[model samples]
Target: MVALSFISLVGCEASVATHPVSGKVVLADGSPVGGGIIKFRTKSDEGETVKAHGQIQPDGSFQLTTFQDGDGALEGEHEAILFSPATGDGHNAVAAPNFPTKYRKYETSGLKFQVGPGENDFVIQLGTR
Candidate 1:
């Protein structure tokens, strides 16, 4: 399973060779927009599409499985997008919590990422008005 612990600002460390990339999605008020999908895709040396993707947690966190041994898209630049369908008036997480169907996965294409091997920090700012 994937690890989901928060990183400390002090001097803790991770020893795995495989790197991790993390980011945050928030609204104009600086509140997090949680629970959706995040995907990263790139072409391999053989020209085949290599995709590493996962879902954002309820608190707006996400982790995608990158290949070990420094051989994946997490080592370089990538693309990103956020898709949440409800307007959040009365249909959002606090009221409904879970969507009736699926997370809106293709509603926005304005997100992009240039991730590094160990840790790439990103903050996505959005508005509801």
Candidate 2:
């Protein structure tokens, strides 16, 4: 059963355990954002920065995933940024930021979250411009 043993080993090596992280995005008025994207970036103890991203649902819920779907993010502190596609007039070609421009950059957003060894659930509140 050498082949069987090898197959099992391969499968185990391919799967990495991850902590679960989920959150909700809401505005200052406490209304859910219809659509957007959320991202988390953190520097590991090794000094390498890792990023995880998730799509904001219509109900403003999101789950962070790094390597695989729903696999979750690396454990540590993270800076978060939220973004939604800005609408542009037919005459203007450039699309502006839908949310506050300050929120588009992780460093400027003033949004931070710490991920522990276990599951993390967070509620992110956004301020109006």
Number of the top-ranking candidate, with lDDT as the measure: 2
RMSD value for candidate 1: 10.4
Candidate-wise lDDT, in order? 0.54, 0.81
Q: Put down candidate 2 lDDT per residue, 1-129, tens digits, no spaces.
A: 999999996685356345789988888898877577889988766687778898888888999998778878888888999887554577875433277888889879999999878889999887764
- The TM-score obtained by model 2 is 0.75
**TM-score of each prediction:** 0.57, 0.75
lDDT of 1 by residue, 43-109 (tens): 4445655556655676766666655422324355556554543545555534222322322332345
Worst 10 residues of 2 by lDDT: 9-18
Evaluated with TM-score, which candidate comes out highest? 2
